[model samples]
Target chain A: MTAMNPKLIALDWGTSSLRGFLMGANGAVLEQRGSPHGITALPEPGTAGFEAAFEALCGEWLDRWPALPVVAGGMVGSSQGWREAPYVRSPADVSRLAAEAMEVPTRRGLSILIAPGVLSHPSGGAPDVMRGEEIQIAGALRLHPQLAERGHFLMPGTHSKWVDVRDGRITGFETYMTGELFAVLCRHSLLGRLMPAEAAAPEVAEAAFTRGVEAARHSRPGDLAHQIFAARTLGLTGEMPAAALRDFLSGLLIGQEVLSALGHSAQADTPLALIGEEGLCRRYAGVLQRFGAVPALQLGNTAPAGLFHFAIAAGRVAAAGEPAR
Target chain B: MTAMNPKLIALDWGTSSLRGFLMGANGAVLEQRGSPHGITALPEPGTAGFEAAFEALCGEWLDRWPALPVVAGGMVGSSQGWREAPYVRSPADVSRLAAEAMEVPTRRGLSILIAPGVLSHPSGGAPDVMRGEEIQIAGALRLHPQLAERGHFLMPGTHSKWVDVRDGRITGFETYMTGELFAVLCRHSLLGRLMPAEAAAPEVAEAAFTRGVEAARHSRPGDLAHQIFAARTLGLTGEMPAAALRDFLSGLLIGQEVLSALGHSAQADTPLALIGEEGLCRRYAGVLQRFGAVPALQLGNTAPAGLFHFAIAAGRVAAAGEPAR
Candidate 1:
């Protein structure tokens, strides 16, 4: 009674949340589910807790297709997750990433392979690393092969990644704590004291954000610490409304990140491929466009695409089959 | 019998703590006292609560010299403080600062003048302001008049100030949130999670700090956010000890601040006058020296000296008297 189409399960398990995607042989998503039981939320560090959470999240799919192989990525493969899938150093590609996947046995007969994160050792700088984003990058290259030829990819989130891809491989990348800094400043710093208690409306946020971007564009790199205080001054001077302070701060941080990335990279004028959630990606895209970098937006989640690519490369899923197009 | 020496009280009343200096007419500290009852801890926002806290901290001195005039600086003059002393726009000197001091009536028939903060509008940049640090700058100038000729003064603290003084007046200044960012990162950010619970010892902190400073000196300004993550990676890689992470972070932030300030100012090669608490000032002096800026350390409390200068300029105290030397 098994379904005619063979399927594979791809899980994007992170520190605080988990997403399970059931995909057909051709990389088409069959069913998807999410849960808060991420690595940090699992009962314990052992196989039992991980299996329990995994089953709870995807037991229905397993019931429909008992032998579906699961490929998980992100924190689920970190030291604290279900199993430690050691990081693969750059320059890395889908093949190396897939080859490095760690296998774990489940109570049921299903096989699970966890994709490894990527690390880069800059010649004279501190090492850079990324976990889930590498999977997304793999998926991005699969979706837009043109990105592999030569392009920068920006995955904006808590720790935004500015990645450089050359000849279908990740050459190097830099991670900016822009998102985290924005959150901390808005929630914990004196600047946060001036923001409205609730979130600002979209239009209000957009306007303030634009102002912040403009400010950063005209400022020197060393002036960030000083520029941040402008949030308070602008509010006090009645030039910027208090409600817009939060978005303004967000815009400033993001704008600074973009400027910093461009200043550090050789691809300032080259178009960037942005892959992430719509809202954040759109925000990044807008800022990029404002700064004169053409940003090609690839919306919707890419973890499934990444996981599916890794699955096929690992020989867990047949590569010859057509996706359910 | 009233004290043989006529005296003035210099109060450094900030948000979290209060310090009162009983100064002789000759600008020598006769007695000093401190209390936890800062502006924030005062019972209420009005004059009554302020008076109560003031009495609790300095009632002894007031009793000794019943008609002594009090010169207060710092947050005590903010809108949330005892009385709003409007900020004097720069390029300001002690004269301009003294002219803008606000007077408030006390229950004991004593006069209180709160010295104004300084505001800087850097032409194309946002306005910058500082409350207590302006007083310190005045004191630094008074202690060593050479500083006024032309010098860069770094007052390192929660909101570190880099001041440009020329010809006995404050021309411009920039504020860096180094200390606050360190606190927030070590207490709230993921970086904090990897640090030891207790503060690092001086020697340990110094070594780690030097390393951080060196790393920062060689890095591009845009790479700071990425470089900060090196704290985590270094810990993971066992290149940096866990106990030293705090100091390393402190070093990295201070180093970045120094670099940024120098980069933004015209005084890169000029010796820096560091005025603040001994420990923080020493830390800054070391970092400054490492970066090839001759750091002249002005130790001990400068608030009293600053307050004395303001008292004389405002005509609350006689101008011809020499400071006790």
Candidate 2:
């Protein structure tokens, strides 16, 4: 797809990977690009390498249409990114991204705006931070105005974010490094060594996942590490499927977030909206319900939606927006 | 040391390595040998390559002291060991080793006896198991009868074990897997990626260790995985010593064990005795005290002393037996 007259280039750059969508003024995707390169791959933090990597991946589209404005989010705004865009603490409006936006210096005549992440530090729970999900959540709300009212939002990715919204503003959120930890533990840690040669069926993982979440809710938190060993023992003794161990681990993590969320506020049964990989998000929704949260899984490219919505609200979008590229 | 009168060889093999000590009828150290061969390294589990590896390392001793009576302990009796020496449930006696021993039919004309590890399902705490530490602890008690009474026993190694004793029997114990996890986390996990090029300094590690123990006591136990990020964050922010993260990690593990122990028992002020590397043991004592446990750090070679004492009690040596060769 040619970027001839795309309204905006929305980019989601995180720790280990990057994704971008060329969107029309109406918030419809015209073209998309994704790569393994992420903020973590930069040779030097906050160096030209960041720009070089992005240019290498997205230069073709930009060359086809030189005047397209860009809005980027995720780890691209951290201290190690192109420019440090400080987090806006909740309660935050969708316009916060545009309001607190940091301009990136570019060699090409392209105006690029990097959206800052959001941080929520309530009194009891651990301080949660996000860079990319904020833009998506904002976009999701823009797509469906009804979500502006009270609802729980789950943005699932490497560092899965669960955000709470009320009256068109983000009330607070929590970050669970679920995906990253799963990869690390499953591929690198002792747990990986103990895992069987073959992964179990998804049905097994699903069951284990459910049990794990429930276990996390009832058990003392410190007992989690030991419980992992129990999974292996059960498997070794022919009591549990190995695939379920992976689900159990996932359950433990998500269950922990659910438990922490419960600890933070009294609204445990609030309806939850999820934005993430379909399967993983469904797993999380299932876990949320286990902890008494009503959750709904949503589908869409949230970054572009969020960037476009937030950009328009912040008056960053040009008046002569192109709805058709 | 020559195997002048090697009567039998007592071996304590584990997951990663093997140790065999040759003794005369008096349970005296005739000659000792260790090798890279561990239970994991063996060609197959359950004693297939056990004899060959044993003979390869100390065959000379066996030949010199012809027709020796061999007694082994630890993983040698595990499912992964030479033979599955079934676990002996507590309250177990030393005579159980000689009476219920699993004998390996050897090609070297040596009558090999493998000691059974201990397994206990405490009425209060989660089920626990011991492999080599049971024998070592038994040996330590044989050497120091006073310690057989109510006191604390710390056997620090890969899976560092903290054992509790009351009235001449092991009431309960907890295995921290501290060393094993430390090695895994430092070399394999994402946490290791954040470590400085140099090793953590002793002083810095010591300080972090104390703080970590305190944090473990007061912090939400379920938040440990996230809390680990603090090690890197503290170092990055210059709020904590960079090299001390290792110490902090150690402290956290030990602190967790201490917390678990105190949680399950009514007596928190029972005298503590640590048996491990002098420095590590001392550090453990310090952290234990910081977390409100009265501890005593003992200076000694864990394996030799523990083995010696355990051998005498296991009846490998008669009361009037000759000194170790």
- For each candidate, report its DockQ versus the true two-chain complex: 0.56, 0.24
Best by DockQ, which number?
1
Instruction: Please give the range of 10 consecutive residues that has the lowest summed lDDT in model 1 chain B.
Output: B316-325
Query: For model 1, what TM-score is found for chain B?
Result: 0.93
Tens-digit lDDT track for model 2 on A1-325? 4334577778888878888888776777888888877888865455677778778777987888777778788888888787888888888887766788888878786657888887766653335566788887888887777778877787765556668898988888766555665666677665665676666787786777777776677656455455455444445444567666776777776776667655655565565677877776776667766766666546666777887886676565643443222
Cα deviation of A227, candidate 1, in Å: 2.0
Residue B168 Cα positional deviation in candidate 2, in Å, after optimal superposition: 5.0
Per-residue lDDT of A96 in model 2: 67
lDDT of 2 at A240: 62
Candidate number of the best TM-score: 1
Cα error, residue B111 of model 1, in Å, equals 3.1
